[model samples]
Target: MTTPQTPGTWTRARAWLQTHPRAWDATLATAVLACMIVGSFADPGHHGGPKWGTRTPDAPSLTLMVLGAAALVLRRARPMTVLAATGALSLVELVTGDPRTPVAMCAVVALFTVAAHTDRTTTWRVALPTMTVLTAAGMLAGPLPWYAQENIAVFAWTGMAAAAGDAVRSRRDFVQAIRERAERAERTREEEARRRVAEERLRIARDLHDVVAHHIALVNVQAGVAAHVMDKRPDQAKEALAHVREASRSALNELRATVGLLRQTGDPEAPTEPAPGLHRLDELVDTFRHAGLTVEVARADHGTKLPAAVDLAAYRVIQEALTNVQKHAGSEAKAEVSVVRVGPGLEVTVLDDGPGHEGAPQDGGGHGLLGMRERVTALGGSCSAGPRPAGGFRVHAILPVQNHARQATAAEGTGNRV
Candidate 1:
């Protein structure tokens, strides 16, 4: 809300004046000096007053006024120079004893210049002594009585103006500094927010890379086998083609879920657990059975309470192991899936009793091992998947309990919470 400017008067004039570069400040002093010079030319006793002042014809006082105005203009660029010019003109007024009031006006302008440009210590070094000398000398050095109240009034008002101008400049500098610091802090916050968003994008990209690369590679290999064996082994080729179709569909679905995370709007209808968790272990085991692989599930931690993330990770580990069995393990391979509750953590173990495929190349250039490692680390868990010593493959994950996972991440200086 803007405060209303006073209607058609001094306030509007002042607002416009303030917009100029130090013009309002110098304008008042210039106008007062001009009035003083004009007064010096007025009839001395025109109003029957003892001395109406400014009655003297144009001469040296006019020159002094011109010098004072020029000093006002140069105040900001060269404060000391302006002060010296005005002071010299004031001394001349003291000697001539003409243009009596305007000399005091010039001294006041000089004091303001010193206060606004120089520090307070410097202002004291120059202004205080100059004011004392000017006030004392202007009264005593002239025909005026030493006890004249008019001279004392001049000294008090001029000192007050200088002090006020210095305070205003000081306040403006301080407020400007605070505004700059606030702007910098706000920019820093925005940069930090953007960095966090970029990290999340990287994480989802890795998930898509792992899922698509592994599944599509299997589909490619199966399609090649099906095409090669189509005439001689029609039934075997049809089965391989069916597996390719299933793998491709699964890959498409996983890709969709990963891409969904990029949307800005949170899905109100989205499920809390997007991936199939360990609760679907039976369905997963049956899928492997239908894919012509023997699978056994040993549940040591069935029905145990677990966080959604831990359950999801455990389920994905088993799912990936079985999928690898179908793709890489020869048709007669047997796989074992185990879930156990260990000390402060859940351990998921997958064992395959068939030759595990090694050196599998990925389409997007990331092996499933690398993908699993990233997810496990992000969740503050440990995962190791490799070929077993006895001619098979083993994938094991030990994920902390909900409370332990939160504590572990905090201890590691990661602000991400469970």
Candidate 2:
């Protein structure tokens, strides 16, 4: 915790400094000028330290030193200009005075600014030449030995300034990279969330399509039957009306359950019952049978347990296929549905023995076949719907059950642990 806290605090401080660069530069200028002024008054010749006798510079030389130091306040904005101006001022001081003030401090500050703002290639290019020229000029013109402390001090200060500035630049770049990575991760998370929402909405749409198409078709047929025989056969009409009522009621219940899922948090709770799957196939077939269509179901999977997703998808495929048969094929048609387990996959095939396409009803843009295909494909399965060679329409889907089941089990285990 301490380690993480330390870096966070340091990053905040660096950000503040970057935002107020002018103020920080002004502070640097003030410190550099103060050091030059105080050093000028100290006795350089005294081997005994702590002697501060003033060496009063001429008016013109004092003015130039003050201007050079003050110019450092603009170092961050115009580093090259400040460096050139301060370097020229320091050369002037070295040639005119016997014991010059340390105006080179301003040049050192400007060099640091340049190094921090620019790249290493530019820093090396500028630093090497500035160091050589400033040191040579001081040594050649001053009334001191070539190896004097003042001349060596100038080189040391300038070199340290360049190194320190480069380090600061590197740290700034590192922090910027970390910030970019965090933002990119945030963007990726948002995209994944949107993708999941889209998939869930598609699934819900498929469910609604299956429910509405199947139940409404049955109600329409039974209502037609009820109206057709109302005058002569009143008893048969009453039975047809009863079937209509039952179909409509089932439609309303399924619709209520589906729509409840889309309500807001403040709304009433939705039905908590699990969605329909293979166990409801018999009831589904019975509804079609009551509506005067023959639906045969043959299962050879031998009670093999299925994952929730696979089961739901299988149920939806059968429901949609049967609904298509009821709508397209005539009332005299028959549908056969078979679910078989072959190795690691489950195959569901629905076939209807109706008249060929010339006699079948035109679909007029239905979503049943497309929704079944989407559901099967999403589960990494294959589905095909077409007219059979000698008979009516056929829809076949092969779903890889074993892999999906194991994946769901693993996910459940991980969720339980969490």
Q: How many pairs collide in each candidate, listed in order?
A: 4, 0
**TM-score of the candidate numbered 1?**
0.67
lDDT of 2 by residue, 1-418 (tens): 3554455787887788789988777777778878887877765766867467657556766777789888998887788999899988877776565666778888888888889999888887888888888888879877777777778888898899888889889899999999999999999999999999899899889989988988898888888888999998999899988988998898888888888888989999988777888988899889888888899999998998988888988998998888878878778989999999999999999999888555332356677888889999999999999889888999899999999988988999999999
- Whole-model Cα lDDT per candidate? 0.72, 0.85
> TM-scores for all candidates?
0.67, 0.81
Most accurate candidate by TM-score: 2
**Would you list the clashing residue pairs of candidate 2?**
none
Tell me the lDDT of model 1 at 175: 92
Q: How far is 322's C-alpha from truth in model 2 (Å)?
A: 0.9
Question: How well is each residue in 1-418 modelled by candidate 1, as lDDT tens digits?
Answer: 9998656878778778878757875786678677767655554333565454445735677777777876777677788887778877776676566435456677677678778777778887887777777777768785456666546766786788678868977887889899999999999999999999887776676567656655775677678779989999999999888988887887787777776666566564332337657888897676567556799989888578777767766776777667776676677789998899887878888888786566332332545667676677777899987777887778888887867556656766755542
lDDT score for residue 360 of model 1:
35
Q: List ranges where model 2 is wrong by over 4 Å.
A: 1-53, 58-97, 119-142, 145-149, 264-266, 357-363, 416-418
